[model samples]
Target: MEERRRYRRLPIKLELEINSLFKQNNDIIKLNNKTIEVIDISKNGIGIMCSDNFPVNYYFNAKIEFDEERYFYCVVKIIRSSKQGNKYCLGCEFVGLADFLADKVDEYEELLNKSQIY
Candidate 1:
């Protein structure tokens, strides 16, 4: 299959906490606190693996903590989902992310590549 993604995913792991979920019409869905694993990320989106059952096209708000001082909060829409053993792997697109942040993702990837050369 041909790769259709506009940006390449960086194989980085981060823990994200699902703060809320919403439908396309902006109706919120209440749920207990759940932590999920972010498997990969790009400028436009991220791939996550979690046990929480999220239907495709639904939007969820999550906070990704890069470190002690850096935290990013965003809304992501589920584009694809598949069962992986006991968990579900979801492909999602970030909604309304700022351009500078997207550029930061690209810069992070460049820095990672440079580190591996040493």
Candidate 2:
């Protein structure tokens, strides 16, 4: 028998900024700066490809904009990371997300569904 994953993934294509900080719950941290391309995004979290290495237990703030009109801020915790060619794959769990950002994620998922990209 083959194992099946429980969580459903939605396709996302967006550019995001990662700014790591030493303190938690604060958006003032700027440990390392990098630009990552989001591969997938959900209400709970996001996955992206980056070139830098972020140590575990690191907390950071992310700014993602789907379009010129839509943008959001999220506090993210690095859950898992791996290297794929020249880019590193990162799975981050969202923290302290506001209702507005959650709504935007839902909207993006719905758009992906209608476009048949899921």
Candidate 3:
């Protein structure tokens, strides 16, 4: 497959609760008691694994904790998904995420690079 992503993905696992999830039909869903694990992050999007399936183009809001003290409350749109074993692995893109927060992600990536971590 051709690499068309504008930014590189950084491996960063963060668990966050879904405040709300909106389906394409404008229905609201609450995925409680299930941990939505953000497995990877980039300036434009994130890769997440969860027990529940997120339909493509559906949106969800959550507060993603980048670190112990840093958090980003943002809306994400599920762009793609696949069933990985018993888990639903989905790729999501930030919707209207601020540039500063994206910069923060870049900074984290640079730090990981310096540390020789992928």
**C-alpha TM-score for every candidate:** 0.85, 0.75, 0.87
lDDT of 1 at 73: 75
What tens-digit string does per-residue lDDT give for candidate 2 at 5-63? Answer: 34455777877666554546443556455777888877778888878766655667777
Clashing pairs in 3: none
lDDT of each: 0.81, 0.74, 0.85
lDDT of 1 at 7: 92
Predicted structure 2, TM vs. truth: 0.75
Clashes of each: 0, 0, 0
Put down candidate 3 lDDT per residue, 10-116, tens digits, no spaces. Answer: 89978877766797687987666457898999889999998878778889877777676666778899999999999999999999999987788877877788999
Deviation (Å) of 111 in candidate 1: 2.5
RMSD of each: 2.3, 3.3, 1.8
lDDT of 1: 0.81
Q: Which is the better candidate, 1 or 3, if ranked by lDDT? A: 3
Total colliding residue pairs, candidate 1: 0
Candidate 3 wrong stretches, greater than 4 Å: 23-26
Clashing pairs in 2: none
